[model samples]
Each structure stands twice: as structure tokens, then as C-alpha cells.
Target: MGDTRGISGIGDADDIGDMGGIGDAGQVGDTGLSDGPGQAGDAGGADDAARAEDAGRADGSSGGETLGGRDALLARAVRLRESGHREEARTLLLTLSERCPDDAEVAYQTAWVHDTLGLEAEALPHYVRAIQLPGLSDDDRRGALLGLGSTYRILGKYPEAVATLRDASAEYPDDGALRAFLAMALYNTGRSRDAMEILLHQLATTSQDPEIARYRPAIEHYATDLDATV
Candidate 1:
């Protein structure tokens, strides 16, 4: 089972967020989001980060503070995020985004910071933009798909969540995190049995693959819980 759901379980959104393997395993917001073929922000209590630097840059207030060159800006933004300085990161990334609206990475990272800030409404368009761009790393593209899917869920767009997750799953069926997230969305939309069935199938497959068998316990426990709860 290349399904990376870990044997001990579906775990926390905080934990799952780091699954992206983005700037040191790009993370997501904790709770309900999956590193599923997709994953959000309350990381390290980094979730509820300080709004100290929020200067309405997103609205064009401080949008003109040049973040140096593209590479420098990217490096800085990644560092700010890794260090849990999300507000500053968004500020820098937002400026970078306006200067390079066509740059997919800028668009994506801007959205990432917003999602981290629990500003899904703000993150929404950028994620969508990143997804539509022509050139993106396979992982980053998947990240966008996963991010947008999770964003839709957070925004109560269950149908969009289901659709987007399903689309990503089709492309990466081996991604267990993505599968777990799909199950969560399915369950949310009144498809508990369907969700449980998917987890159970993944569990059975994981049990057969020695390479990933280490994750079996988590899957087994989660499956049983799904059986009981849903």
C-alpha cells in the first residue's frame, strides 16, 4: 500500500499539513485537511499566528514594497513560513504576487500563506490560478489540487471538495492521505458507508504490501473506528 495513511491512523490536520514535502514538506491547516493527494494552517500553533504584520497588503496598502528579486523573495517567504512567521510571509508573498501575477509559484505560495492564516476566502483564487498554470512541479500541482480541495471543504463547498478530491485521487490513487481526505469529504456529504469502504479497501491492500505494512495498525484502527462511528 503506497497509501501513506500511516498504520496508527488518519491523524491530525496539523500533522497531515506537512505531507506536501513543500519548503521542508509544505504544511497545511490543522483539522480535516489531508496531506491527501492534497492537506492547511494552524501549524505549531502557527495556525493561530499573530496578525501583527497584517497591513492590508492584500488590498494594495503595502503592495509596493519590492521583495527584492524573485528568487530572494521566494526564499524569504519560504523561510518566514518555515519559521512560523506567517503574517510576514503573506506580506512578502503578496507583494511578490502582484509583481508577478503570472508566476505560478508566487500565486501558489501566496495562496498557501493565506490558507495557513485560515484565510481560505483569500486563498481560494490563488489556488485556482496555480492549478490552471501551465508549468508546475508535479508535487506543487498536486499541492494546489489538494489545497483547493481542502479549501472548498473549509468553505462548506462539499460538492466541490468531493469533485476535486476525486480528480486528484484518479491521478494519485497510491496517495493514502489524499484517499483519507476523500473519505472525510464523502462522509461529510452523507456517504459514510462509501467512505468506510474506501478506507477498508486501502487497509486490506496495505496489509498485503510489506513495504508499507508498517502503516497497517493505524489503518486498522481508523477503519474500525469508521465502522463504529459511520
Candidate 2:
């Protein structure tokens, strides 16, 4: 089998400073003047309010900065990978992941780049993180599942490979690539008969070759009953 790496709200707060002690009837030391809405206490309260507003703005800006250019960067990384500049793509994706650590797309793309570079071990954690994290697009989710399962198989984790690929195949029952990978994993786990059934079924359904097309009915029949005498 070919080892192909398939890669694809907030709220505000309120002022709790007592509004310059509006209810306080007592005066300061001996000045005989009660604190009011615009006194020193009130000024301090205003300063606090201003500081809070400034903090809120800073937080908003910081959030924007975190993900501001992430899409552009991700696209550039993808372009680099597609163009066969895998090393450069890996570096760019690494930087993007660091900047957008919680970003699902960043995590997925990072894993894919590592896979293309033959760094399956390094790709493992990113794949796990991307799958666990939410907001992943449907296409990327499919790719991530296939990549994770294939990587597990490559690493000799046959059981994990089978389980992951089985789940993926269930989720995407019509995905031939997933079935192909799952069949390989099944063979690795000594289920060669089951594996052949899946491969034969896939070939019968998806192949366009004239020879296979001519024999499609036999292939489909044998796929389910490999030992059938008739």
C-alpha cells in the first residue's frame, strides 16, 4: 500500500465602587463634607473605571493579535507544502502553531506537514490535539482521521490503527481511502480474510478499469464469501 499523507463570545462588567459612596452620610476627618459623586473618592472611582475600560480594550486587541493573520499564514504554509517545499512549509506551520496554539486548523496543518516530511512520530500529538479540539472543518476532519490512522499503522500500533480507522470508516462509510487504510490495518492485525474482503469490495465499487468492471460481479460476490465453492 502506498503511504500517502492526506491532509486537508464575551461580556462586560459593572462598576462596584459604590459610586463615590453615595450612601455614606459621614464626613471625612474634620472637613465636615461627605463624599459625593465628584469628590476625590469619586475621581479615584473614575480612574478605576477608565483603567478597567483600557484593560478591556487591551484584551480585545490582544485577542485580535492572536488570530489576526492566522488565515493568511496558514494558506501560505499550504501553498508551500503543495509546491513540494516541505521543509519551508514545516517551518512556517511550526511558527503558525506556536502563534495560534489553540487553533484547530493550525494544529491539523502542522501534523500534515510533519507527516509529509517523514516525521510521523512528531506528527502524532498534533493529530491528536487537532482531532480533540473543536471547530475543525469537515474536510480536514476526514483528512485528520485518515492521517492519524495511517500514522498509527506506520508506527506498528496495529490495534490503534485498526480502531481509529474503523471509527473513521464508520463516520465516512463511502470514503474509499479510509476503507483502504483500514483494510491494511486489519491485515496487520492478522485479519487477512476480513482485509481482503474490504479491499475487494472497494476495488469492485471504485475501480474504472475495464477488466475489473467486467469481473465486478464476481469480485463483489467473492468479497463477502471468499471460500464459496460455486
Candidate 3:
């Protein structure tokens, strides 16, 4: 329920292949993989407040090793987002995106930073661009798709959300949570039958998962109300 939704996991480059499920608190799906928001940098303090701190640091320094550069930029973006200086963060990310055009991580983080700042429209292209980058692991691609789908849902672009989620679900067929998100997207799009099917599949496969069970009521409500509402 935080500003950034959870996704899969995060680790070094070698672990990208095995990364699955959504990220922990403060993490959001970036490439269908679970990654914490501002994963490459410090993420202390409360949401907006932490972002402000990061922005301050980003503005102060720009020299470092490769990892240091990424971390510094990420810190700046988070801080700018926290401080409600979304335009500044966007500008900073734009520069980074240009500098690292081939780096999917940079594009993914840029898109997510924008999403966190509530600029869904602005975030979409970056997500798409990141996903298209070569050498991106499946987990990363999945995370990006999930992020894009969720952003679309927030923008009331339900059909796009459904499509994007469907694509992700196909890639990660065993992920019940991914299916659940897809169901939610479908429900939002007035696709009650499809949504119910996805929900049923998720429930059948994850009967013991309290998280999955938590969605039953909402799914049921959507099913029953389909005709009258959506």
C-alpha cells in the first residue's frame, strides 16, 4: 500500500536469473522482478522524507566508481521524489537515461522513479524502453511489465494493464501473485469472466496463502457486480 508496490527480488547480476516473487517492503516491480524502490541507493527514513535526503545527496556529488555513480543518481532521484520535486527528478533521470541508453537498469529505475512521483504517463515509455534492452534477465523484464501494468491501472487504462499483466503471467506462469495482479487488472477492465478465471486459478494453486485469500472478497464482488457495474 505504500507509494511503490512490491515486486520480486534483488541481488547481484548473477542472481538475476533466479530472482522471483515480489520485492520486500519499499520495493516495486521494475522488470517483472522484485526490486526495492531506490534499490541502488539508500532508502532510509519515511517515504517522502527519505526521497528529500536522497535528492540532496545527488545534487552534491557526481564522481565515483560505476556502482557509486548509479547509487548517487538513484539517491538523488529518491530524494527529489520525497521532496515533491518531481520535475527535478524527472530532469535528472532524463539526463541519466541519455547517458546510459543501453543500460536497462538505468531505464527501469528512471521509469519507476517517475511512477513513484505519480507521473504514470511519463513513466510508461521508460518502462517499455527498459524492457526492450538486450541482456535483461527474465526477472527484470517481468518486473518492468508488472510496473507498467500497475501504472496503467492507476491511470485508468485498464485494457493496457490487462494486456501487460497477461504478458507477464505468461512468462511467469507459476507465479500465483502475478496471476492475482492480472486478475485485478482484468477486473478493472470489465473482463469479469477472465478475471474470475485467473482468480480461481490463483486460489486453487495457493489455497493456503493468506495473501491470495485476502483478494477473494474483492474478486467475488467484482464477479457478482459485473453486470450491474463494470
For candidate 2, lDDT tens digit of each residue in 100-165? 778888898889889988899999889898899997888778888988999999999999999999
Give the TM-score of each candidate: 0.62, 0.71, 0.56
- What would the C-alpha RMSD of candidate 3 be, to one decimal place? 11.6
What is the alpha-carbon RMSD of candidate 1 to the true structure?
A: 13.4
Error of 3 at 42 (Å): 14
Model 3, 38-87: lDDT tens digits are 44233322332333234334446322223434444444554555556666
lDDT of 1 at 226: 65
Distance from true location, Cα of 191 in model 2, Å? 0.7
- Candidate models: Cα lDDT each: 0.62, 0.68, 0.60
Q: Rank the candidates by lDDT, best first.
A: 2, 1, 3
lDDT of 3: 0.60
Cα deviation in Å at residue 24, candidate 2? Answer: 53
Per model, state how many residue pairs clash: 22, 0, 23
Considering lDDT, which of the candidate structures 1 and 3 is the better prediction for this target?
1
TM value for model 2: 0.71
